[model samples]
Structures are given as structure tokens and as C-alpha cells.
Target chain A: MRRVSLLAMVVVAAPVFAGAVADLPSGRFAPLYGLDVGQTSFPVRAFRLDVRPVSRADFAAFLSEVPRWRQGAVPPALADARYLATFAASKNPAAPVTEVSYFAARAYCSWRHGRLPTTLEWEYAAAADETRRDASQDGDFVQRILDWYGQPAREGDLDGPGSPRNVYGVEALHGLVWEWTEDFNALFVTGDNRQDGDISKRFLCGAGATGSARREDYAAFMRYAMRSSLEARSVLPRLGFRCAYDDVGRSP
Target chain B: MRQLAFALCLVSLSAAAQGEPRSVLALETRWRTESGEQVSLSARKGRWYALSFVYTSCAGTCPLTTQKLKRLDATLAKAGKPLDVVVVSLDPEHDTPEAVKAYRARHQLTSAKRWSILVGEQEQLRTLTMLLDFKYSKNPESGVIMHDNAVFLVSPSGEVKATMSSLDGPLDEFVAAVPAPTKGS
Candidate 1:
């Protein structure tokens, strides 16, 4: 068996009796990247995602098991210089661990017998509000998320700064830290901004043909842009990740 | 003196043959070629090759990328440089063996002797892509798959050697970098 010793620094996490997993029901919703021509809706099945981003303590526990992933021990191909930079400075175990590369994040999730959520799963879950499952159309909801996007990243000890909880009992989906989705690199934009005519046709596949369904939704567009800019090995100061499990065959 | 010289030659030849990283050679995932022939990465041993991931239905970078690889292969062949091209499907769900064959025919890439367009199970694809650090995802709503557009060079020992974002990128440099196959490797 492969062991990865993740060092969990001393920030404490609140105990969720349910092991910190929130079960989301199946539903259909319009994603930021809209449906193909003649398609009406996107169906998302039931699954469990971490209620919060993986925190310092959680990652520390991971490091204690998987030593290969520790700072300096990890290969440059797997993570860049900034991987786990946050854990090095402060011992805020409860704060969300940031500065992790997609490879490192994926390894963490796989170790737990889970995987990173798909782009659609993340988008579908993030679309919810405190009460409503789909609050994307509400102007106030959209504005608040946009405001969070514009604000500068908060520095140090980000354990639990109390972002709004969605109806599914998930926390800090936004307004805390940017996240690593399994398919982050799938959002393709050309390296150069030489857009002539029919940008979608020139660059992307089916969904790219139609562009974004909600072109007015700047917040969604911003998310897409951010996702597009990342590479698998890129480690940023504000980026972190959580894990998700398949609903089938796994007892949640 | 003759025996000692032969022994020394054998040691050097074995070292040259084992030059690739052990991790890459250990990969045993199976993939079905556009011609419906099942193969594995290890089957590509004994030959230098370049690989890229794309789907047949893609109206985006896939076509141009195919053309570029075709050109690279042609140029190498004309120069009498031996190289193989392997294109794996990112949209394996839609790019069945038949679909891959159609794609090959459409692009005139039917030379199984030179080019191989392949598809495999999702888990197999995942294993290969992860090894190469290739990222891809299917748009759930649209059924469109998007992926990183990059080519990887694999040495004759089946180890990944170099990567390029586009097919037209630094071909000469890559050609110079590729390790020649050891005899009987």
C-alpha cells in the first residue's frame, strides 16, 4: 500500500456528526457553459461533496500518511514551488489549505477513495442559495457572488471565516478561496486574444459553438476565465481543493 | 581481449536500452486503435513516437492538430527519420472504434503503419492522461469534450521525453532530442 504522510498543523475543525459530507439530490439546471443545440437541460445525479474545502488539519492528516507529497519531497512535475506554502508559515489546521497544484489535490482525493468533483457538479452545487436549490436567476444572489469575486483574497488563518451556507449545508463555495475542479484544464481558450469572427467555432467544441447561455452573467464568465488560466501543475496562493465521492456503491 | 570487449559492449547496450523511466514503462492500460486493434503503451516499445489526445467529432483544434501531426510524420519520413504517431481520444464516450476509423478516413490518417488513432475505457484513458499530465472533461450539458492541446514525445523505451503545446512547436528541437532506438530493444 502506498502511504502519503500529510502533516496536519494545529487548526481545529468543527465536528459534523455526518463526517462533513452533505448529500445533494438529483436535479436539472442550466450551467454557465450552456447546453448544445437542441438540448434543453442538464441532469445532475445525487452525490456527496465535502461541506467545506479541505482544511490544513485535514491535509496534515493526509501528509502524515503520504510523505511523498510533502514540501520539497514532491516532484516538480507534480507541483510547483508554492505547493503547501500556506501550511509552512501558519499552523492554522482549520483554515483551508491553499497553494496546492491540481495533481496534488487529485492525489489527496484519490487517497481518500474519492475524487475531485466534475465541472458540472461543482457548478450545479454552487448555484444554490441558503433556501433555494437554484438561485442563479436572482439578481441579488448573482451580485453578491460577483462582489466576492472582485474582493482581494483574505490573508492568513482562513479556517472558517463564515461564508454563507447553501441549502445543502455546504460552506464557503465562494467568497473564501478559489477551488480546483477535476476538469479545470478542460476550459480551453487560445493563448492569444486574437478574436476575429465566431470565436466559439474557432476554438472550442459543441458548447463553445453557442458560447455562454447567460452572457449577462459576468460572475460565471469570470469563473470560466479563472479556470481556463490554470494548468495541472500550477499552484497559486489562493487556490485549494475539496473531495467528492460517487453516489453508486459507496455507503455515504 | 575480444571476450572482454564483447562483455563491455553488452553492458553499455543494456544501459542504453533501459534509459527510460521505470514508471512510464510500467503502464499497461489497454487501448483500441481506430482499426479496432487492442494495444497497450508498452506495445509501442522499440520505436520512438509522439502522442496527442483528441476526439474525432471535435470541430476545434483536433483537425488542425491531426494535420500538424501528419505533416510532422511526413517530414520525418522524407528525412528518413523513424517516428510513430499515436492519437488517443479525449472524448472516448463518443469516439468509438468505428467513429475513430471514420475520423481517420476523413483526415486520410489511415496509415496504421504510421499513425494510430485510439480509444480506451475511461479508467484506462484516465491512467494514461494522468501519466502525461493531460487534462480533459466532457461538458455534461452539451456532450462536448474539452482538453489540453499538447503533444508528448515518447522514447523507444516507452518513457515520455518532451511536451509541446502545439504540433508546430519546435519540431527540430524535438527531433534532435529523441533518443535513437537501441538495436534489438
Candidate 2:
């Protein structure tokens, strides 16, 4: 067997987002954004939001419209109809679709005239706070996130479009299913390879101790450890993705 | 701010403990191989092992991974050397010994002395996988197993030496890396 070095130059395009809506406060418990190694804040204009997660009904429509999406037509590994959670059986057509791979999700996003959100764009949206945090200090931005997560999701669930504004006016950041990012290797915290090293540099939303934070925090370490264990291919039922479109003027 | 700091401390301690390899954490407490035998990393010490985590009902890369392992086994046999192939089931509740036996036969894994399929409690599987940095999650609605697809090669001392694409293409590199047993064994 040939030993091919796992080293390949990962050419990642910058995340597409609109202009800096506001410089929000960092989450109290979360790591400060842009503190990570090799962190590059992409031009915000490239990302157009898909406010909600893709639903079962949405994918069913896709399957019907796209011949390649039919069972047995796509990659054999992904050809199972069971991949799409049936809305009729669950009676929750609005629930995020489950059992789909990053590959399948990417295909769906491409078919829908959009692309998956990059890790930077996803974290910025989740951590952004328009009112209390965005208007105040970066610490306040972090505090708002802590406050949001502190309360029961059902109680604090923001409704309507403008109820709770993020830096970019996006809402429902934390409560939604873990969104898929376009850069699969974007958040590597620790490991043997340079690819892993590069990911750690983009640590924006994950809980971890930066050079500024006290290094002895146990909770921060656990969060970072869990983050490090993640691989691009691992998918969970609770994991769903939102689409992003390159704003007409900003796409490269 | 004080409370947040304290919480962060607790998280870091737990994460640090998890990151450090807990040598005393026994694998036997967590899982058993397909032969209904308890498995422990310590038990397999002093031999190079190929490890893959899979479930029985997988219609995707799991079967392909198994076939790849079998091909690696054949290559090893041809070289007059033998290697240990350990397939740890990610779906322990459904992948019972009987189910594994059937899977083994279906895959024509008749040469059992060199290969072993193992399943154990979910907690044990989780612990072992975490130690190896293998990520897996169960889909609650469909009960499907979602996991990373990399095979680990463990050194004779039971530490992971390298991770490879699959068992087939990287067979020779892995075989070369394993330390040959001492004479008069």
C-alpha cells in the first residue's frame, strides 16, 4: 500500500456575507471572534441569508423536481429514500431535514440557487447582537449570547423577522440545528496536521480559552476538546444547514 | 463574570481530562468483539491492529470499508505475515453477535483467526471512540449511524500510529510500519 501524505493544500474561498452591519459584543462565555489564528473576516456582501433551515417539504419538492435526486440515481451510498425524513409520518414539515450527508446537503444547496454558509459567516450570524450587544461593547455581545443560552430556548425563542436582531439582522442563531459550513476544515483546534492547525485559527464561536482568557477553565477546555473531535463527514439528526447566496455585487 | 469564570474552569478541567489518554480506562467495560469476547486495548498490546468502527445495516461506505479490510488481509497473508483487523460496531444495540456473525458470513470473512468484529454498550463505544478521536452520532428519528470514515493503525504498544484513507490502498505502508515480532516467540 502506498502511504500518501494527508497533506493537501486546502484552497478555501472567503465566506460571503454582507457589509459589517455592526460590530457586536462578544459572547460572555464564548471566545472573542477574530482572535483565532489565520482568521480572515470575509466581505459580508457575498452572503445572502436563507432565514430558516431547509424543511422536509422543501427537500421533497426538490426530489420531485430534480431527477438526479431520486433514489438510486444519486451516489449509491446516498440513494436511500429513508435519507429524507417523511413529513407525513412526522407531521412536522417545517422540521429540519435529517440523515443527509454534507455531500447531499451541498447538492441540495446548489440546486436551490445558493451555497452552504461558511464557518465564519455562520458564527458571525450566531454571535451577532443588534440591540444591547451591537450598540455596546464587545463584552456585551458575549453577554447577550450567554443570556440567550441561559434561558430555556422555548421561552426566549425570538419570533418574526426583526424580533431579535443579530449583527447582520439574522435571528434564531443558537436554538436551530447546528448549521453546516462550506469550509469543512475551518475549525480545527488541535491535531497533527497543518489542516487541523489552520482550523484552530478560525475559532470564533466555540467555547475555548484564548491567549487572553485564564487557561485553567475546565468548561472551556471541554468545549474545545469536543470541537477538536469533530470531522466534516460526521452528521447528526440534530444537525441541519441553511443556505447562503453571494450578494449580487460582492461575489468573486 | 465570576460565575462565568468558574463554569469555564469546570469545562476546561473536563476537556483536559478527556484529551489526556486515560490508560486505565478499560475497553472490556465498554464493548465485546463479534465472537462474544470482551475487548480491551491492553489485551491486544504488542500486536499491530487495524481498527474500523461500523454498523451492520449501513448501505454506504461501511461495506466498502469492510471489503477494503479483507483485501488488506489477503495482501498480508500473501506476504506470509498476519495482522489483526478489529471492526468495532457503532450500532451496538442492533449489531448483536448473531447479526455480526451473519454479516461476517455475508462478507465472506471466513478467515476468523485474523479478523474480529466487536460490539459493546454505547457508553463503552463512545469512550473508545473519543479516545481515538473518532466522531459518531446516532440519528434519533431514523436510528441511523453517522460516523467518520477513517481507519486507524495502532502500534504494538496500543497507541495510534497513523490514520489512513482505507484498508486497501494503504495496506503496504501500514504493513511496513508494524514492528515484526521478536524471535523465539
Candidate 3:
């Protein structure tokens, strides 16, 4: 019985060490942006993604290990004036961390031997509902996402229930917070996005509903527009991140 | 430079640990030069320089940027405030040493000793570009890289002093931003 108990302990311990990742299958992804004039779907390779957004507790542990990332110690180039502002608000171990800049989030992932997901990978994993993969076509799933987007910002639901686990076993992709991607700033917006919107050739796609590959995927376009507007160092109260791993069998 | 001023969008950056302006020198990523040697930018510290991104095979815009840079170099030299030009390759997968040599010959840049062309891994390229707000993305299918045409004037400490568009923006303001050469070198 003691030997059996020891074997069970090892079984539970292995996944915890791996930080709970899910292996998403390879697919042809059609992101809302980045496709050129005739470019169709992007061939997305299979990759591992964190099961949930990086939690406040996870980041706190990282900060403890690497003090340079502590609230006041981070360099100005790596984070903004409000970087990690929510670290102290809630110590809930499972809540998504917020207010981390792209650079800082990238660093945390690097320290863990992983990196932030590409925009395509993130969107691909997020397209699923609880029961089915590729549910972006489902009107109910689309409306539910829009409804979450329309809701008022939660003050600080450190321990609130996350988005239910999807078919891929990933959780809290939505109804949680916006995330940092590996190349969030690669977007080319029409007009001077940094300035007043005007006529400019740099406008990547067209504009409004017309700019998107799938007009029905308005929620994805909103996410793209929001991503385009951000600077690498701009950290917001709702912006957090998760890490994606390259090696599937190896623990992160 | 109306377009340039709009594109740069240089935001307020607080001083670094050295109490200096936010500097790109803090990045530790090393790059491979035209000689195929990997090196850090630290060797070029303590001297103001101009940096831009390009690909040897880029048929559009990059050539324009290079010509503008050559013109800018001559203008600075004539003004006695000459600065080195650091050009990073956008496509390392194809910008091999031979391609770099061909590029130098095609652009007539072989005699342009002040210019340094460097290339490295895509990850490093992305990191450096992000820090400088030098946007670029390579199309996987066509191997075409769509990038911004901005050129940055960096300080001795690696902080960006000013920027200008190489495609159409004027150059007088960018030239004036470079500090005059210190007395007696």
C-alpha cells in the first residue's frame, strides 16, 4: 500500500512540474490580420500552450526568484509606469496576472524555458467552445464571446471561476483578460494609428468590417485592433499573458 | 518629416538604472556582421551612430533607404559630425555573406567604410526590432518581408535621438539632430 501511495504521488507531481500544458494539433489558421493580398490560411505547426493564463501566484513566485522584475526594480524600457500594479491587490494563486508589459511577460516565459504564443496560435486555441474545436463558426459561441467583451470590467475577481475548460482542456482564454503575444506589434494599421485615423498606405487590410477575412469574426478583429494600438512597453490593468512551450514531452 | 514624426511616436521613456535615457544597448543579443562574425553592439558604444533595417535582396524601399543613408553619411561627414551606420538585415535566412557582398557591389557601398551590415537569428532580429519599434514581418509563403522605412539617429549611449522616413521624408531635421563633432575629436 505504501508503494502504491508513493506511485500515486509521483503521478500527480509530474504534471504540476510541467505547469499544466495542452498539446494543440497543427492546423491552417486564418488570423484576422497579417494575410497579404492573396495569402490564404497560415500553416500553424503543432505546439504546447499553457492550460490557463499565467496566474498572479505564478508571477509572484517568479518575482521572488528574479527580483529584477519586482514592481519598482524593472527598467523603464521593459515595462511602463503601471507595470505589475495589480500584484498586491489579490494574492489568489489561480487568478490571471494583469498589468505586465510585453517585455516583462516575455522575460517570465523565457525564465521558464517557454515563450509567448504567436498571435495565430493564441487565436487558434481560443476559437474553441467547451465541447468542440473550431467553434468560431457557431453563432452562440460568437455571441457569448461578444457578451463577455461587453460586460463591465471585474474590479478584482482573484478567485472567480474561469472560462470553462475547452475540448483542448485549456481554460480562461476568455472572460478573463487580454494577453500578450510574441509579435503583437506586427500589425500594420491603416492611417496613422498612433495619430488621428486618416488615409495612409500602411493600412494592412481594408477598414472596419470590410478589412477582415471573415466579416462574421468581428470579435477577433476587435482583438487585432486592440493589439495594433499597443506599444511593447504599454502595460494596462487588464493585459496579462501565458507561456507556450516548444518541447512537448519536456517539462516547462 | 510630417509622416516620420507621426510614425515614430516616440513616447516618454524614463531613465534606466544608470539614470540615463532608456537605451537599446542594454539588450545582450549579438549579431553576425558582414564578415560572418557574431558580435555585440558594445564595441560601438560611446559614439553616436545611425541604425536601420534592410535585406540585401529587397527590391523596393530598402534600396531607397540605403541611398538616403549614404546621402546622410556624406552630409554628416561634410558637416564634420560623421556618424557610423549600422544596418541590420531583415532576412537572415537569405542574407548570407555572398548575398551581402553582392548587395555591397550593387548599392556601390563597398567604398562606404562607415556602413556595417549585420545579420542574425530571426528571434534576435524580432527582439531588437521590437525594442526599437522597427516593425517587420516575413511572409512564410512568398519570403517577402514587409517592414517600416524608419531610420533612427541613436545617441552615444544607444538612446534614439531622432528618426526620419527614408522613402519620402525630408532629411534636414534628422541631420540637425546629430550633435556637432566634439572639439579635437
- Find the candidate with the highest DockQ and give its number: 3
Worst 10 residues of 2 chain B by lDDT: B17-26
Instruction: Please write out the lDDT profile of model 2 over residues A89-122, one tens digit for every residue.
Output: 4434445655454556767887877777655456
The segments of candidate 1 whose C-alpha lies over 4 angstroms from its true place after superposition are A1-19, A188-210, A248-251, B1-47, B56-68, B94-111, B114-116, B123-137, B141-151, B154-185
Range of the 10 consecutive residues with the lowest summed lDDT in candidate 3 chain B? B9-18
Q: What ranges in model 3 sit over 4 Å off?
A: A1-18, A189-207, B1-22
- Candidate 1: tens digits of C-alpha lDDT, residues B47-160: 778888788888877787787787777767766676888888888788887787788789886664778777888867776775565666676756676666677788777677
- TM-score of candidate 3 on Cα atoms, chains taken together: 0.86
Model 3, residue A11: displacement in angstroms? 22
- Model number with the top lDDT: 3
For candidate 3, write residues B1-185 as lDDT tens digits: 23222322221122111222345775666898778787877777888899998898888678988998989998899988888999999999999999998999998998888889999888888788877766776766788777777788888877888878766767899999999987987
User: On residues B1-185, what C-alpha lDDT tens digit does candidate 2 reach at each position?
Assistant: 44544453443343222223322122233457666666676777777778887788887668878887887778776776667888888888899888898888889886667788878776466556645556555533356555666677777766677666552355667766655656865
Compared with the true structure, the alpha-carbon lDDT of candidate 3 equals: 0.74
The share of true interface contacts that also appear in candidate 2 amounts to 0.00
List the candidates ranked by lDDT, beginning with the highest.
3, 1, 2
- Which one wins by DockQ: 2 or 3? 3
Q: Which ten residues in a row have the lowest lDDT in candidate 1 chain A?
A: A1-10
Candidates sorted by TM-score, best first? 3, 1, 2
